[model samples]
Target: MVRRIETDRLILRTVTVDDAEDIFKWASDPDVNKFMIYPLHKDIEVTKEWLRSRDIDGNDEFDLGFVLKETGELIGQGGIFYKEDLDAWAIGYNLRKEYWGQGLVPEAMKAIIDYVDKEKGIHAIVGEFAKDNSKSRRVMEKLGMTYWKDCQYSKFDGSATFDAYLYKREF
Candidate 1:
């Protein structure tokens, strides 16, 4: 099950196959998916199939849709998941390009972090970004995450790889 997290400007809630259309708006955008691990969705069915396979209950993954409170539009998707290697939760997000720089990333993520801290008593939270992704780096920094180490990440399909930085904040 997905958790519901509310912010002043957004509501993050369970993302289902019903959200494929709205999510595809950004999922299919090359610029938006450029740094993402998943392949560019060629059609809505791919998204629906993906959603059907998503494991939100187990794996300590609470994937959710970021919905605008004002108009109830799904703008993006992301959430926190357990990172076994770090023995901590790791954060991840992807937003519509139009929504970038509006500070929603930090707003939404802080809510998730706070929820995790309250519910799980997490000692530490982490966020990682490609070195070339300045916007993501800033989001981590704004969320009070400090650079922890140099890291590397790859696309889910292993089609591409990138040098990244791991950022962490301890509660």
Candidate 2:
């Protein structure tokens, strides 16, 4: 089962269909989508459909909703998944523009990384971000993840391509 994680100010729980609206808030924002692999969600149905397709059962991977503890609002999403091709567990996250520069992503990410290391005994965690996303890169750096390499990135729908910098933390 997917475990619910709690930080001092946030709750990281499995995504639900009910979270579509909040998800769309950021998923549709141009600033948030500027570096993401998926296009901006044009409708709530799109977010709902995407949530339905995610395998958040805890057996495979986790795509969690990051909720604010004080307001009980989902501020973002974060997850780690095993990549067969790279033979490593890859991590990612997205947050609403208003929450940017708050150090929330790193807090949530650190919780996930710790959980995975303890429960899964997996140490190879990788991350990648658009080269232009310095904020994201800073998160990786804060995690002490080392720069791996740069690779080509394509949107899920094949609508765009960009250079992506990869980082990895191996225990």
Candidate 3:
């Protein structure tokens, strides 16, 4: 089930079908999807399908919509995916270009990380970013995760791949 989390200026809650339009606003941005593994969304239909298929069972993963409390607008999304190979939760997020560099990611993520640790009984969390995505790298560092190693990631279809740096935090 989707859970609701409140921070100083934002709310982290499970995404729903109604959020399709807002999510598409960022999901469709080429600049936003540059380093993302998923292909740029061509239309709102694709985003709707993704939001519809997104799992909210709180099992292996959870995707949340980051809502700005001041305007109740969906600014972005963030979540933790369980990596079975590493036996740890991997954190990820994306935001609209307009909201970039505002330090909003760590605010939303800090809440998610805390929730995972307290509720899921997980002590280790990992984050990865494309080697050239320095913006994401900074966000990871601000989250107190340290550089762990370099790794390669590819889309499910194996059509595209890139080198990435892994960051880790263990409590």
TM-score of each: 0.95, 0.96, 0.95
lDDT of model number 2: 0.88
- Extract clashing residue pairs from model 2: none
Could you tell me how far off, in angstroms, the CA of residue 31 lies in candidate 3 after the best superposition? 0.3
lDDT tens readout by residue for model 2, 94-134: 99999999999999998987877777777588999989889
TM-score head-to-head 1 vs 2, winner: 2
- Give the C-alpha miss distance for residue 39 in model 1, angstroms: 1.2
Candidate order by lDDT, decreasing, is 3, 2, 1
Question: Which ten contiguous residues of candidate 3 have the minimum total lDDT?
Answer: 153-162
C-alpha lDDT of all candidate models, in order: 0.88, 0.88, 0.89
- List CA RMSD, all candidates: 1.2, 1.1, 1.2
Cα shift from native, residue 140, model 1 (Å)? 0.2
**Candidate 1's residue-wise lDDT over 2-56, tens digit each?**
5798999999898888888998888889999888889898898988899889887
How much is the lDDT of residue 144 in candidate 1? 87
Give the per-residue Cα lDDT of candidate 3 at 162: 83
Q: Look at candidate 2 and tell me the lDDT of residue 163.
A: 94
